[model samples]
Target: MNDSPGWASPGSAPSDEPDRGTEEQPTPAADADGPAAEQPSPPNWSKEQPPAGQWSSPGIPGQSGPAGGATRARAGSIPHQGGWYGQPAGGPPMWGAGWSPAPQAAKPGVIPLRPLGVGEILDGAASTMRAHWRTVLGISLIVAAVSQTLVTVVSGLWFQGTGRKAAPDGSSTPALRQAMRDMADTLAGSAVTSLIGLLATLVATGLLTMVTSRAVLGRSVTVAQAWQDARGQLLRLLGLLILYPLMIFAIAAAGLAPGIILMATGTPEAGLLLMVFGGLAATVVSVWLAVRYSLASPALMLEKQGVIASMRRSAKLVRGSWWRVLGIQLLSFVLVALVESIIQIPATLIAFVLDGQSLMDWANGTADSAGWTFLIAMGIGAVISSALTFPISAGVTALLYMDQRIRREALDLELARAAGLPGYGTDTTSAAAPGAPTDTSGDPTPGS
Candidate 1:
C-alpha cells in the first residue's frame, strides 16, 4: 500500500510494482576505496530501522506491524504497492502505522458536536441556562410574571362570588343549582387563565428556542437578540402551538362524542362502557401523534418553516424514534412538575395562613371575594415556578431536536462549521461526505 497521506485507496497508489525484496539481488562490485568503504557509516546513516511491527497505529490499539508483516515505511515515504506502510489494500491501518488519532469532536458550546445520549441532552439544557442565565432567566421571568399576574387577576375578580349557595331550607334543588353554578364559574375562570398562560408560553418557547440554538454553537445571545432572531417565525410558531392542541382536543372529543350522544338518547349503561373504551383508544392515538410532532416548534423556529411544513419535518425526524421521544418528553414534564411543586407548595401554605378567613368562608360556601393577600402570594409562587421551569422545558425540546438531527442527518458537521471550529469550517470536502444533508434551502425534506 502507498504509505503516503491522502492515498486512502490502493487504486490511488503511485505504482503497482512488487516490493524490491522480491527481486534478485546483484553481486556488489569491490568499493573503489576498499578500506574507507568498510569504515563505520556517518552519524546521519548510523540509525538502524526499528524491528518490524515495532509501531502501532495511532488511536487504534493492540495491532502490531503493518498488514501481512510487510516492512514499515517512514513518514512522508510512499510505498510502491500494498497499503499504507504495508497495510493491506482496502483494510484499516494498524496502530502507529501511518495513522493518527481521530480528532475529538468540537464542543464550542453547551453540547459536543455529535449524537447525544439522554443524560447529555438534559445536561446541555441545564448548561445553557447556567452559561447564559441573564438572557435565559430574563426571558422566562418576564413571561411568567405577565402570565401569572393575568391569571391571578382573573381568578380574583371573575370567581369572587362563585361559591356554592345552599338555600336556608337546605333544599337539594338549590344545593344542586349552586354546585352547577360553581362548576361553570370554575371552568370559565380556568379557561381564561389558561389561555393567557398559553400565549405567554408561546412567546417564551420561541425566544428560548433561539437562545438554545446559539448556546449549542457555544455562543451567548441577549434577550433582544433572541427576540430578533425568533420574531420572524413567531406567528408561525403560534399557529403550530394552537394547531397541535386543537388536534389533540379534536381526537378526544371525537372519541367521547358517540358516548355522549348515546347517553343523551337514554342508553346510559352502554354509553358509559363505550366511553371508557373509546377514551383509552383516543389517549393512545393522541400520545403517538404528540410524540411524532413534538419537534415541530424547534423546526419552525430554526428552519423558518411554515406551521404545516414544520410539523411534517418533525414527523419525518421522529418517524422511527417514537418511544424514545415520548420517554424524553415525559421525563422533562415530570422534572418541570417537580420543580413547580417544590416552589409553589410553600407559597400556597403561606397564602392559606395569611387568608384563613377567606379560606373558611369558601369552605362554608359564603365567600364574597378572593383575599388580595392570598391571590398575591399565590401569584408570586406561580411566577417563580414558571420562570425557572420555562427555560428547562424549552431548552430540552430545542436540544432534543438538534440531537435527532445529528443522529440521522449528520448535522454535527454543519454545526461545527457554524461554530467556526478549526478544520471543520475550512474543510471543503466534508460537504460531500456520505449521509451529510446537502440541502441549504431550509425546505422540509424527509431525510434532511
Candidate 2:
C-alpha cells in the first residue's frame, strides 16, 4: 500500500508478489515455438497430488521453507496457526508483520483535530467554558441579566393591570369572563417574556459562537473581540431566529386549519379527531425540522453566511446523520433543562416564602400584583440559570458544527493549519484559511 495515514480505501489490499530480493526468481519464458517448448509439461492437478497434510499452511508451524524443513519465526510477524480458530494462545492477535499504529491526532485546543464522538463533543463544550470562562460567561451574564430584568418588570406590570376577580354572585358568566381574562394575561406575559428571551439568546449565541471557534484553536478571545467578530452577522442571525419559529408555526397552523374549517361547518367530532392527528403529525415534522436546522446559528456566525444559506449548510451537514444529530441536540436540551430546574425550583420556593401572602392571594384569585420580593427572587434565579446554561448550549452547537465538518470535509486539516501546528503545512505569511477564525465585517452575503 502507498504510505499515507489512516485506512486505505477498499480493494487496495497488500500486494501478494514476493520480495524482489528473494533467492528464487521466475525467469522470462521464450516464445511458444522456440526450442525451450520441447521441455516436458508440468503434471495436471488431478494426475499428481501431494499426500494429505504434506504441506502446512503459510506462516504455520511445520511449513516447508527455502532452508529445508526447519520452521522459522519472524519478529512482529503474524502467525497463522489453527488452535483457538484465529486468536493467539496467550492473548489477542497482532495485526500483521508490517502493522504499525496510526499517528495520534493533533489536539491544540479543546478537542483533537479529528472527527469527534458524542462525549468528546460535550466535553469540548465544557472545556471551552473552563478554558475561556472570562469571555464565555461574560457574554452570557450580560445578556441574561438584561433580559431577565426586563421580563421581571413586564411581568409585574402585566399581573397588576390585568388581575381578574371571581363573580360575587357565583354566576357562570362572570367565572367564564375571569377565565378569559386570565388566558389573555397569561398569553401577553408569555409573549413578552419569550420575545425578551429570544433577543437575549440571539446576542449570547452570536458572541459565544465566536468564543468557541477560537477556543477550538487553543486561542483566547476577549468579550469585545468576540462581539466585534460577530457584530456583522447579528442582524442576519436575528432574521434566521425569527424565520425559524415562524416556519414551525406556519406548519402547525396549516395542520390545524382544516380542522378549524370542519368545525365551523358543524362537524365537531370529526374536526376534533382530525385536529388531534394533524397536530401530532405536525409536531413530529416540527421536531425533525428543528434538528435539521439546529446548526444554522453557528454556521451563520462562523461562516458569515446569510440566513437561508446557513440553513442550507446545516441541512447538508445533517443530511446523513439526522438521528445522531437529533440525539446530541436532545441530550444538550435535557442537560440544560435539568440545570434550569435545579436552580429555578429553589428560587421559586424562596420567592413563595418571601411573599407567602401574595402567593396565597394569587392562588385564591385575589392578588392584584406580584410583590417586589417575589419578582426579584425569581429574576435572580432566571439570570443565574440563563448565565450558566447559555454557554453550554451555544458551545455544544458550535462544536457539533465543527465536528460534522471535520468528519465530512476533513476540516481538521484546516483547523490544524490554522492553529499553526508544526507539520500541517501552514504558511505563516499567507492569508487565513477558509475555516480559520478570522474577524469578519459588514453584512453577510447571500448564497445557496
lDDT against true structure, model 1: 0.77
lDDT agreement with native, every candidate? 0.77, 0.78
Candidate 2 lDDT at 274 equals: 92
| lDDT, candidate 1, 168-248, per-residue tens | 585666766767877788898888997898899899999998888878877778998878777888888888888988999
Candidate 2: count of backbone clashes, pairs at least 3 residues apart or interchain: 0
Error of 1 at 356 (Å): 2.2
Worst 10 residues of 1 by lDDT: 439-448
lDDT of 1 at 15: 61
The model with the greatest TM-score is 2
Per-residue lDDT for 341-429 in model 2, tens only? 99999998898888775566777878655677889999999999999999999999999998888777777766776677876655532
TM-score of each: 0.75, 0.78
Residue 223, model 1: Cα distance from true site in angstroms: 0.7
| Deviation (Å) of 235 in candidate 2 | 0.4
